[model samples]
Each structure stands twice: as C-alpha cells, then as structure tokens.
Target: MDTLALKILFMVGFIAAWAIRTPYQKRDKQTKRLAARLVLRERVLFVLIYVGMVILPLIYVFSPWLSPADYHSSLWAGYLGAIFFAISLWLLWRSHHDLGRNWSPTLEIREGHTFVSSGIYQKIRHPMYAAFWLWCVAQALLLPNWVAGLAGMISFGIMYVLRISNEEQMMLQHFGEEYKAYMQRTKRLIPYLF
Candidate 1:
C-alpha cells in the first residue's frame, strides 16, 4: 500500500484501540483518586505527547508539509512499521487487560488498586509505556517528515525521563517491599534486557 493508505490504516487502528478502551478507562477514572497526584510536569508532558504523537502526525500526513521525498523509507520499512504498530496494539490491549481497574491515565492510584505483577506486567513494570514506545518507533518509520517522524520519540522521551522515577517512587511508597521486590525481578520497559 501507499504511504497515505498505510498512515490511514495505522491511525484508524490506533484510534480504534483507544476507543475500545475508552469506556473502561472512563469507568476507571470515576473511582476516587488517591495520593500521588499528577504533577504539572506530567500533565504538560501528556499534552505534548498527544500533540506530537497524534495531532502532529495527522497534520503532517494529510497536509502538505516538509515531508521530503528523501525522507520516505522503502516499502520494506513501511511493512516493518506496520509490524511495530501491530505489536503496539497487542501490547496496549494486554496492558489494559492486565491492569484492569488498576489502570489510570495519570499517576494517581485508585482505591484498592492492587499491585499488579502478572501477565504483561510480570516482566515489564510499564508495558503501556512500552507500547507507546513501539508506537513511536512505528510512527517514525511510517511517516516521512522529519518533524512528524521524530516527534513521538521526542515527546515520549521527555515524559519517560521525567516521570518514570517518580512513578516508581510512588509505587514504592504504596506497595513498599512488594514493589521493590517486583522491581528487583522485572525491568522497567523491557523484559530481562533493560
């Protein structure tokens, strides 16, 4: 398929995946918020990531931008991008499934949110973030524009750097020795390789 077709396909899948989870996420959000609220930096980072990963890419793909022909990768690369996207979709769904009510858009913990360390979470403390990273890689490969292609990594990179430690700290505070033990056994985003 052509680049536009591929972009459309990927975006549709991405949006659909989120749409399927929207109801669950909304229900999850209605729960009472506990401690460890999202700081301003985390909020700002999320906004930047949404813009860079979603809005910017949509504009760059549909509108005429500096997406020079030189930046467009080979057809093989697009196929690879599709593969990455598929992996992202699977990981995203599984992350949500494993997280269940434990999932939150922000850093805040839910009432009765158990420390999860099974399924995808068994080896990766943040599979959703891993999914997002895969999405970024897929975006970079699928999109041709330098700005659109790299925006996801840049956007998520900032959040990952600033928020990960804080998140782990919050988890540590809440789960204490259990979380620390989990950390000792599991890597942050990758499995047995971080």
Candidate 2:
C-alpha cells in the first residue's frame, strides 16, 4: 500500500510536468522524412529507453517493497549530490532559456530551426539531458530513499537515452555537414573530452 502510494506520487509529478510544458513547446522535427535512414536497433533501443525509465523504479518501489531504513547515505555524499544537482539545474535553466521557442517534449525540429552552437551549447550538445542526468544523481544521493532516488535517476536517464540519439539523428539529417562540424567541435552531453 505504501509503495503504491509513492508510485502514484511519482507518477503525478511526471504527468504534471509532461502536461504543463510539453504540449505547448512541441515543434516539428522536419527531419522525420529521413526516418528511412534510422536503424531497427536504434528504434528498439529508443523504446526500451523510454519505458525503462518509467517502469524501472516502479519495479523496485511499487512491486518490491522497500523502506527508508533499507537505504542509507552520508551527509557529505548528500552535500555533493546537492552541489552536482544544483549545477545540473543551472544547466537545465540555461538550456530552456536558450531554447526559447525551439523547445519541445517530443522529437520536433522546426523547418527554420537552426542548430544552437553558442553558450552552453558551445561546450555540450545536450546540456538539458546532462542536467537531467545530473539532477537524477543528485536526487538519488540526497534522498537516500531507494525508491525515490531510483525513480528520479531512472526516468531521467531513460528520457535522455531516447532524446539524445533521436535528436542527434534528426540533427544529422537536418543540418548535415554543419551538424557534423558542430559535433566535431562540441561534446555530446559532457562539456569537455566526452
């Protein structure tokens, strides 16, 4: 019963976010025409990534019961997680600010959408995803609640895994040589040497 309640709470938050921002921000990827070029493995991987994050934590929390005492963390570790998460949040904020009208929940790249190569984009291609992952790690560390932390990290990771690959493929199809050059110039998710 307790586990189910926690799962409900987690889902409520996820649904709330998807509802509040995703619908309004969605844009067309224009590169969907290149769908023929995508590999079957990639498509399968994408689905797995999406569902994995959503369901993985549920397995641990809602399916198998766990408690606070079942998990543990040090204050220092929590603090470190907080710092990393703060950095991640900052990155996420900047990504949103920079994206402006180009933001969307689904894979949508507008007809006039140009690749962003400046600001945080200069260092990392997927600052938003990186931020999400970082925040997940932070949540996991700070909460020290196995279920909550796992859900945060897993869901965020799943989103990133799907979005990054899809976004990259779309960019490659849309921007072509320019995107290639940019990829060479900047890292994928990490800022340096990643």
Candidate 3:
C-alpha cells in the first residue's frame, strides 16, 4: 500500500480505538464529580493535540494544501508504522480497561476513584501517554507530510511535559501516601526505565 493509505489506516484505527471507550467514559462522566479540571495551559495543549493529530492529518490526507510535496519512504517503514499504531491502539484499550470509571478526558479526580496499580498500570502509571507517543511515532512514519507527520509529537510533547508533574501532584494530593508508594514502585510512561 501507499503512504496515504497507511496514514489513513493508522488514523482510522486510532479513532476507532478511542471511540470504543467513549461510551464507557460518558457513562463514568455522569457520576464523576470532577474534583479538578484543566487550567488554561492544559486546555491549550488539549486543543493543540486534537488539531495536530486529527484535523491536520485529515487535511494532509485529503487536501493538497497540507501535503504539498510527496516524500518517499520504503514499504518497510509503512509496516513498522502499522505495527506502532497497532501497539498504540492496544495500549490505549488496555489503559482504558485498567482505569475504567476512573478515566477522564481531562485532568480530574473521579468520584469514588480508586488508585489503580494492576495490569498495565502496575508497570507504568501512564500507559495512555505511552500509547499517545506511539501514535505520534506512527504518524511520523506513516505520513510523509512534514506538517502533519510531526504535529502530533510537537503538540503532545508540550502537553506531556507541562501536565505530567501537575497530574502527579493532583494524584498525590488525592491519594496521599498510597499514590506515593505506587509512584515509588512504577515508572511514569516506561517500565524499568523512565
């Protein structure tokens, strides 16, 4: 298959994976108290990520403005991108499964939220973030357009750097020593090394 096909497949698969969790998240949201919400900085990052990963990529795929010049990469790169995308999707699914009702689109403590340290969560505190990184890498590999391909990394990388400490602080405040112990045990986005 060609680069455009690979890009479309990756993006579609990414959307489908996230869409699968929408209902569950909505159901959880009904009961969630929203102890905290994203501040202006985080909200900015959220918009950036959404636009970079979804809007820009779609434009690049379907329109000529974004993808001005066609760059060539080997078929092996496409296969590698597909593999990364697949892994990302799996990580997303598993992270959602582990977090369940505790999951929120933004930074917020859910009502009756429990500190999860099982399954994939046992190894990494933020598997979802890792999945996102994978998605970014996949996008870079699958899409040849510089604007679309690198946007995910640039947008999401900013968010990750700004938000991770705040997220950990929020969790630490909510869970206290329990979360501290969990943090001591597991890495943030990688296992054994961070």
Candidate 4:
C-alpha cells in the first residue's frame, strides 16, 4: 500500500486497538472539576507523541524525509534496540490487558479503583512509559535520518516528563499510600535499576 493509505490503515488500527482494549468509560465525568483535573498539556502530549510514534515509522515506509544514506549501526545497538522494542511493546499490551476496566487515556481513576501490581506491573510501575521510551530510542537506531529520529526522541522526552508528573499526581491522589508503597518497591521507567 501507498504511504497515505498505510497511514490511514495504521491510524485506524491504532484507534480501534485503543477503543477495544480500553475497558474504562466516562459515566458522569462531564463535570467541570473532573474536566479540570485532566491536564491539557499532558493530554495533548499523549495525542501528539502517540501519533508521532506511529506516523514516523509509517513515514519511513512511505514518505522520504531524508533518503537512506551510509547510516551504520553497531551490532549491539541493533540487537539491544530490537529486543527492547519487542519486549516493551509486549509489556505495554500486557499492562493494558491487565488494566482492563481501569485503563484511561488520560489520568482519571475510576471510582473504587484498585492499584495494579501484577503481571508487568510487578516488574515496572510504568510499562507504558517504558514502552514509549523504548520506542523512541529504538526508532533513533532503526531510522536513517537523525532529524526524524530526534523528533521522536525529543517529543517522547517532553511527553515523558509531563506524563510522569501528571500520572504520579493522579496516582497519589487516587491510590494514596498503597501506590507509595508500590513506588518504593518499583522504579518508574526502568525496571530494577533506575
């Protein structure tokens, strides 16, 4: 398929995946306080970063931001990045699967929610963030142009800061000491060594 068609197909799949995988709902969240709780910057970053991650790789297959040149990768870098990318994506899918009815695109906790400390959660508190960072670093190695790759890296970095801050605050507010204990036990992005 062509670039535009591929982009459309990927985007459709992305949205559909989220729609199907996300088990949370917006029952009475039309309130102003609840609305205000969702940080606009974080929300925008989530959208932009996610779209950029998907679209950037698609561009590699579609558009030519820059032609492939004499870009070389160390064997170690390729092996490590590919391994991390695959593992990270699997962790993400697992985290989302385990989250089930508790998953939200933004940082809103459902009423009477329980903290998740199972599956990928036991290994890392934020597998989703880990996946994102893995994706950025992986793309930097996988893609040819420094410009395209750097865009993903920079955007993910900014988004990571915002996402961690906002998500942590929400976690604290919703999960309280239970989450604090989890935080003490697990690192944020990295697993055992952060």
RMSD of each: 1.7, 5.7, 1.6, 5.3
Predicted candidate 1 versus true structure: per-residue lDDT over 1-194, tens digit per residue: 57787678668766866775797778875888777556787779889999888888888877776456426468877888888988988998999988888888888888988989999998899999999999899888888668888889999989889888889999999999999999999999889899
lDDT of 3 by residue, 25-118 (tens): 7787587575875667767888999998888888887778875655777888788888888899899989998888888777888778888999
Model 1, backbone clash pairs (residues 3+ apart or across chains), number: 0
Stretches of candidate 3 off by over 4 Å are none
Q: All candidates' lDDT scores?
A: 0.84, 0.61, 0.85, 0.63
What's the lDDT for residue 179 in model 4?
88
Residues 53-99, candidate 2: write the lDDT tens digits.
44544445455444543464555765576567557657766887677
Error of 4 at 164 (Å): 0.7
TM-score of 3: 0.93
Off by over 4 Å in 4: 1-36, 68-70, 73-77
Q: Which window of ten consecutive residues has the lowest lDDT sum in model 2?
A: 28-37
Q: Candidate 2: misplaced stretches above 4 Å?
A: 1-69
Candidate 4 on 29-77: residue-level lDDT in tens?
4322332355777578867776567666566546765545325445565
Question: Comparing 1 and 4 by lDDT, which wins?
Answer: 1
Ranking by lDDT: 3, 1, 4, 2
